[model samples]
Target: MNPVDKNHWLDGLEASVERHLQHAIYYFQNQDSEVLLKPSVTGGWSIAQCLEHLNRYGHFYLPAIDRALQRHDGQPDAPTFTSTWLGSYFTRMMQPETGKWKIKAMKAYAPPPNLDAHAIVAEFIHQQETLLALLSRARRADLTATRVPISIATFIRLRLGDVFAFLIAHDERHIQQALRNLPVSQDIDVQAVR
Candidate 1:
């Protein structure tokens, strides 16, 4: 288990979100549309599709988080958050760690093919900004007590902190997934001539 600083975990996570925003910006600015929209080498989602998938989650989660925060408007933040066992399990499952495990996306979250790469990238940037704003709001609320409904089941709720952790980890997973899907350059041929 990683040590949690009582006062700084959310702030640290906010910083992490900022880093993700910057990374996405770099990708959008540096990568051409052809690269961004190319189908994965593994014949799965393209980079744009991966990002749209994240955006689709944002559409549900961001509003749900907003409502959760509003409902707990009077609650004070605890000195530290300790995630529920189930919440912790779900969060851990989404983390990219070694990227060895691949979970199939539910049908509802999958992005359609041939989406406009530029538009999808822009939407992702906007959503990340919205997430950061929500995290800032979260620091003043009881994150462990604030519950957001899971996308799969509206009745199944997780703590706000866990939701953020899961979403952030999920985003990282797809970002790396999209990067991996980029077509490999085959121009270099270094055959060993013995």
Candidate 2:
């Protein structure tokens, strides 16, 4: 994509991050630990667990994105970004629209039992803000030229645009999961067994 198009996409992604952050903050502030930490009857993840999973991804991608952007600092600007086939495929797989399609989390990304809800929420909020900053830095770089490796295999790299797409889509997916896990009632009174 051209500079204009890339910027427009980043704008939308940043806005989505901001919106997710707001909802997360609202849930964390308004809801108690009982609601946030309650697991599903089928042994699925809780709201805190979902946020922690996203945080695990952020831990990998945020630093990698920062390094990728830095590498493009003195390079000549490219007119357009072309997504790699593998990158595009991964991004498509992670999109929020596919939330109904259940995919098990990698072992490294799974949150443990009895996690601290406040800490997980705080980290997720901070990570979203950091992601927004990274998006701003991305605009200055050539999205097609900058490459970041995935967490599972550091040797494999993808274009910056695809990384952004994957990360944002991944964020949305988990946000949806967390939202679904939330208690409908404001006055939550469940004592969920771990």
The lDDT of model 1 is 0.80
Candidate 2, residue 47: the lDDT equals 86
Using TM-score as the measure, the top candidate is 2
Cα lDDT tens digits for candidate 2, 1-194: 32446777778888878877887787664568888799965688888888999999999999999988887898876655687778777877888655456788889998896988888899999999999999887778888878899898999998888898889888887777677676666423222210
Model 2 scores a TM of 0.88
Find the 10 residues in a row with the least total lDDT in model 1. 185-194
Q: Which model scores highest in lDDT?
A: 2
Task: Provide backbone clash counts, one per model.
Answer: 0, 1
Clashing pairs in 2: 1-81
Q: How many backbone clashes does candidate 2 have?
A: 1
- Cα lDDT tens digits, model 1, 91-171, are 778877644577899999988887888888999999999999898888788877788999988999998888888888788
Clashing pairs in 1: none
Each prediction's RMSD over C-alphas, in Å, is 5.8, 5.2
